[model samples]
Structure formats: structure tokens, C-alpha cells
Target: MWRQSHKPTKLFHRAQRCRPRALALLALFLVASTLLLCGIKGKPSSQYDPPKLKRSRTRTSTQFRPTVEYTNGTDLIWQIPESPKAVLFIAHGCNGRAANFWDRSPGCPYCVGFPEERLIVLHALDRRFAVLSISSSRKCWSLGKEKHVVKWITTWWIERNKLEKLPIMALGASSGGYFVSALAAEMRYKSIVLMIAEGVFDTMGIPEGYPPTLFVHMPKDQRRMRLIERNMEALRRKGVRVKEVRCLEFPLSPNFLSDRILGLNQTMAVKLIRMFSEKGFLDENGYMRKDGRATRWKQALRERGFPLEKYELLNHIQEELNLAYGYHEMTSLQTDDIFDWFESYMN
Candidate 1:
């Protein structure tokens, strides 16, 4: 019987001898399998999360933004030097892009940039007042349904960013002019400058206790001109601090408007702009700068004291515009007048 027991089988002996190691190997396999099934990485989630860049609520897309955003949860922003104290909202007319107003567009005559795009003069003069522009999501501002656009903008900036008390200025051209007028009426902005504005002319400027307003329009453009005059009269009846400049014939050069009708150049609209502040341009004797020194000064008009608006080597923006045949547009000094008035009044 003892002899029959024989030694335990080789496999049985080996298993008994390697029991601890076998157990360890089995445990390791089980753990790995469990982790794989559960979709676990080698490290803790908190320890291995790739860093995410913080973004402002104002940024609508997860994609990187092109400009610096000062406040979170707002669409408004400042460019270039960035984070400025005061801001000017530049609005454009129907179909006008944000840059359609005041940019240099050399090689393109229709661009707003003066000297045909040599510089960004509008913003260059005053670093204190930064410019903010809006694109036309739609060609026109919602005259009725969304007229509260400016109010919403102002409220958002004020409530969340502590800009409620900061002075705001608005400048709009044509339809944009109408849009900003709505804002000027609703908000206690510092000032407003409207060129070829469509709504609230001098008409409502007084009733809303709107800050000082500077309006620029062309007398040649009769319908709008009359609306402006009517607005002014309405304001007078309501009592408003308002000013206006109307151009009957823009100053055109001998070639541009060579054989002048009414003995005037349609080219000199800028001079007409300067003349709006009539008292501001004269001396005690009430004499403005003269055009008598001109090579072609009409003897008769020189005697009448007609002053030139300084269009010497005038900006040929239309040439620059040819480059941006479809990409851009040109605005004239006729429109830039709004910027002048806004800057002056706000300061």
C-alpha cells in the first residue's frame, strides 16, 4: 500500500511549490482586465486633464477669437492697445461693413481712409477715445421689433461689467444714423453724431434730454434734408441743444465740377461741415480764413469772403476703392464729420 502511493504527479508538485506566485499572477491579470473593461486610464482624471484655456462668454464660438475681449458675457470689445476707458460705437448704414466707415484704403478711392488709405486718422488723433464698430447682421436695424438693441447692449455692459456709469458715444451714417438715434434717445450717452441720419432728426433730439447732437446732411438730397429741418424745428419746439451742417453742393474741383453751376464746386462738403459751428470759426471782426489767395479765386466771390475748406491735394479715395471692387466701400469727409463732432462733444 505504501509503495503504491507513488510520489505525487509532477504537475501537482509544481503547482503546490509555485502557489504564491500563481496567485499573484492571477490577481494582476484580473485587475488589468477590470480596468480595461471600465475604460480607466493609468492616471486619475483630475491629474491628467489637458489644460483648457479660459474664454469669455462674449466669444460665441469655441474657435479662437481674433480680437481681445475685455469683459466676459458681452459681445463688445476693444482692439489694438486694448482695455481702454472710453469707447465709441461706430455704426454703418444698410449693407455697410464695420470697416466701411473709417479705414485707410490706399489703391482704392471709395475707402474711408484719407489720402487714399495712408493712415487710420480717425483713431490716430485721440487714443483716449477708442472706437467700437458693429457689423450689419441684417442690412437694417429693426426699427420697431428690435429697437431695444442699444438698450440691451448698454444694460449688459452696465449690469455685468460695471460700465453702467461710463459715458458712451454713438456715431452712425444713414440707416446707421437712424439706429444710433434710437440709442441716443434711450441711453444717457455722452454725445451723438449722425451723418445722413434717417430717424429722430432734430425732431426728437429735445424731448429725450439727449446729450448734444451733431447732424450732417446734404441739402442736395432734398427729402432727407427736409426731414432734418423738420426735426430741428421740432427740437426747437421741444427745446434741445442741437447743431446742424447741410451741404447744398459738395465742393468739386474745376475738373470734378468744372463748369460750376451756382459758381460752386460740389467738392467742398468738408468746408460746409466746418461752418456748422459758425460762432466757433470767426474772429471779433467775424472774419473766417479766406480763399482770396487761391490762383483761380473768382474776384467776385473773394470780395464776398468765401472761405475754402482746405481740400488741397484732396484725398482720392475712389482710386483706392478700385482695389476693393467688391470687398469694401468708401465714405467721404461728409461722413467723417460725424467722428469730428462726436470726438469734440465727448471730450
Candidate 2:
């Protein structure tokens, strides 16, 4: 009867409070133990790890495939190798496309049977270079406009390939050489290889702090060589480094008939005939008669703002003939030498 109306004892109240506190402590202990077990299970094993690195194989050959990009109406053909050490910008001659310079194709009407272009590309790929061939939009290069286009293309290429710190080189033949010369004066190119660059030095003045230049020419390419030498002298005067390599020497053989009747080397003969025909020195049938009055080359030089004496003019004409005839042959023969020279500066 007394228990029915009883108030809770102090001991019972204390026991009830301790029961809630104990339950809370037990829940906290369970949570801590669960977290400790999860941490131990989640620890990484020594055998497996994240953030893996990838290895890429070195590409040895371009074969026939190249990535083509069209920017600013110019075709930029790229033959890029893995881990490129340097960059080579190639500008083809007048009426020449990027394909003709990267590969020895039959489309180039002026030259035949020269695999130097193909070989150069292959060698560059082997050397781990990102080679670029820039095609002119028109029949010939417009230096003023093409210069900016080339710069833009190259800058884009280097950025895309992550080659911002690599050394840059330029190679050009004939008119392409002229373009490269102008570009080199404007930009900071490591070096330039010019093959049969006619009147480039006269057209583009040697800039202060110009890059080291390698002029490749035939020993008989007197006119262009004279111009190159004059430019080299000017560069020297301005304290710029330069080198010239006279390739494909064609010395007259002891055989009198071969030397005289053959009319210079075969390359020279073809070039001379073509030059004479172009300058109106030959008949309509492409015949050069001995009695034809020589064009006043010195007067023409003066008219073009190149002031040279009569004797110098005659020598210049002869040199021009030599260059016109022998350029293709000389370029073909000296392709390896060009690569070697370029290699020296790449380091």
C-alpha cells in the first residue's frame, strides 16, 4: 500500500542519471572504434600507388604522315617527334609548297631526283626535332605579310607543343631564303641556313644583334656569294657571327672536249639557258647566239640601286649565272653538311 504512493528514492534517481551518461559514453566509444578501424583499412599498400607517370616511345620516322594545319590561309605541315629537342622552320622556294620541301615529290618542276628534302626531314625526326614547313599563300612569298604569319604560326605551334624554351632554327631555299633573312632580322632565331638566297642581303639590311647565319652555296655561285659576303662583312662590322660553306665544287675536268663542248656542268648549262631565255638574251627558239649584244648588267644594277663598277657588274653577272645553274645540285649534295652545321648550334 505504501509503495503504491511512494516518491522515487535518491539512489534510484542517481542510478537513472548514471544510466543515461553511461549510454552516451558507450555510443561515443563505438563511434571512435569504428573510425579507428576505417583509418587502418584505408591505409595505402606499398605495392600500389596513385599519380602514375606515362612513358612515351621515341618516334624515328615520319613515313608519309604529317599533321596539317591551315592558319591565316597558309598551310603549316608539321612533322613532330616525341620529346623534341629543337625546332626547324622550313620555307620553300618560289612556287614551292610545304610538301615539296618536306618530301621529294615530282610536283616541283625545277628540280628532279634530289632526295635531300626527304632526307632532311627524316634526319630531323630522328634527331627528335619538331619540323615545320610553311607554304606561301601565293606563287611567291610576300615577306611583309608572310613574316607576321610565320611568327604567329610558330608561336602557336610552340605553345601547343609546350616547347617554349627550345632553340629555333630556319632553313630556306631561293626566295624562301629571302623571307627567312627578313624574319631573322626581325625575330630572335638561333640560326639560319640559306641555300641560293639571291639579293636577300641587298633587300634586307643586316640588323644589329642579328643571329648567326650559315650561307650554303656552290663554289660557282659568285653573284649570290658576293652579295652574301657583303652582308657577312656588314654583319661582321656590326659584330654578328656568320659562316659560309661553298658546296658542290665543279672543277673543269682535264678532258678538253668535256670541259669546253659540254658548256659548263650539266646543272649550270640548264640554268644558264633558262636565265638567258628569261632575260631576253636568247632567241624565241631558246637559242643563245654568240653575236647577241650582252645586256648591260652593271647599268641594271645601278638602276636597282646597287652601285657597282663596270668590272664588278660583269663579275656579278657571271656569278649570277653560276648560281642559277648550280643551286639545285649544290643543295642536294650539301644536305648532310647542312644538318651537321645545324647540329653544332643546337647545343
Candidate 3:
């Protein structure tokens, strides 16, 4: 009697173990049948789906289309949104091209670079602001020579697009900031944003009715910081509204690279982070010990046979590093606040 009972219990346990396998086979069969039916109905299987990528969310709509036009020995890159609420003029820094603010679009083939600045342009467009940028005639902005040309282009663009009723705004960085300040003194803007730059008070002094100006600076150096503070005080004393956004250093994490750039996987991101730590580039808490630009991380990667053929990826990585360091460079980090200044002063 004991032997028979023990045999029956063993058989029952075996049956129980088989149940999960049976269910798994049934699920597999159902999936295959469904896929077969989809094929018979002229639908492709899941193989055709494209892989999702990590990248900037700049809109690729018709209104966000980029256009480049060369006039009077200068290149002007612009985008016009349908029924724009305002027109924003962007000025690039020294040795920077107007293409810095744009990404690759269907209409513009040479519009590939500077993901950081491009984010600022994308934010402006999202706020229904048409963006326009003119490449400096020289390596740096020649305010006296380019002033009339810029004014003419602004007028022609406004008249041609029938956008005279919309408010005009300007954003400039470094040398471009100085140029825009002088331009704003003459042409008048609803508001203006100066990035990594100070107002030209002594030479091209801020007039009494200067536009409400917002300064977005990194304050990485003491001299520049003092200059910006003085400029802000000057604007305030003149009854001009002034606001300042100070950019600061940000700590690094494992996903810092993959989170910002496209075509990088989490595994690769982890490996890179480990490599950076091993190279003594990052401290115990993941903050950069040295300037990112000074770190030869890319050279190390190249030595390890990492692919660097894609120029877009290279540019994106460099910009991300610069942003993380919070150094002197164009940034999209304070984009929201920049536009808020524009909106607050808008009519």
C-alpha cells in the first residue's frame, strides 16, 4: 500500500511540472498562427519596424522646415512658422555660422551641427516665433558695416511675409550679443537675450528706452561675471527691465551620453562611463575633474577603435560635454527662461 501511494504522488508531481511547458507551446502556436494570418492579409510582420533612436525632439513638420538664402555676400538661414506670433533674429558668436542654430531639414542639406543651439531655435519655433539668422560678414560681427544690411534684411523679410504687426525679438551670443545690443538700440526689439555676453555700455551705450534684456551667462570666469553684473545694474538704472540666468556645472551619470546623443545604447553608455572614471576624468561622485573640452576622451575612444566616422555624433558629443561642464559656450539649457523673457515683454 505504501509503495502504490508513493508512485501515484511522484506521477502527480511530474504532471504538474509538464503543465507550464504545455502552456508555453500553446502560446507559441497562437503567436505563429496570428503572424501567419497577418501575412495572408497582406500585412508585413514586425521585421520591417525601424529601431527607435535617442535624439533631440526637434519637429520635422513643414513649418519647421529650414531655408538658406545667400544675399549680399552673407548667408541667411531661416525658418518661418505658419501664422507666427513673433519674428526672432538670432546672431551667432565669433567664428560661428548661421547654421549653428539648425539641424538637418528636408529643404536644407548643409544644416547639420550644434545640437545645443539648435534646441534653442526649436524652442523658439515651438512658441510660434519665426527664426532668422545672418552669417557675419567677417569672422566676427562688424557692427558698423552689418547694421544697415541687417536692418534692410529685417525690413524686407517683415514686409514680404506681412509680419509687420508681429513683435520682433533678438538673441545673440558672445560677439553677436554686442552686435545685437547695438542693433536693438537702433531698431527696437520687444525683448532681447544675451548669452555669454555683456552689454556694450561705454561704446554703444544702452539707451533710455532699451528693450527688456535677459542675460544668460555661465559666469565661469570672474572678469566676465563682474562685467555682466555692471551691465545689469546699468540697464536697471536706465529703467530697463533686466534678468540674469547663471548656468552652473552639472554632475555626470551613466546615461549622460546616451540620454543626449542618438545611436548610443545603454551598454555603451555604461562602458564609456567606466572608461571615463578609470581615466581619472571623473571624481568619486561623477563630477568632471577637468574641463570636458580638455579631456581627450574622443582620442581615447579612437585609440580603442571606436567608430568616429559620423560627424553628427561627434558634434553632439562635444556639445553635450561642453554643456555638462557649464563653460563658455552656446547652450540650450536656459531656453525656457529665455523665451519667458521674450513673452513677458511681448505685446
* Model 3 TM-score relative to the real fold: 0.78
Q: What tens digits encode model 2's per-residue C-alpha lDDT throughout 1-347?
A: 00111565554455456656534543443333222211101234332222211111112245545766678887777777888888999887776777654432333332211234555566677777789887898988877887898898889888998888888888887888888888988767887888777436566677677877777765444677678778777777888767765543221111211122212332323333334555565445322332222445334435544334422124323432332234333133344456666777875
Candidate 1, residue 188: lDDT:
69
Each prediction's RMSD to truth? 33.7, 36.3, 17.3
Clashes of 3: 0
Each prediction's Cα lDDT score? 0.43, 0.56, 0.72
Better candidate number, 1 or 3, judged by TM-score = 3
Which residue pairs show backbone clashes in model 2? 223-319
Query: lDDT (0-100) at residue 194 of candidate 3?
Result: 88
Candidate with the greatest lDDT versus the true structure: 3
The true-versus-predicted C-alpha distance at residue 167 of model 2, in Å, is 0.4
Give the poorly placed runs of model 1, Cα more than 4 Å off: 1-85, 101-121, 124-127, 154-165, 201-206, 248-340, 343-347
Q: Whose lDDT is higher: candidate 2's or candidate 3's? A: 3
**Per-residue alpha-carbon lDDT of candidate 3 for residues 125-144, written as tens digits (9 for 90 to 100):** 88889999889999999878
Return the TM-score for each candidate structure: 0.47, 0.57, 0.78
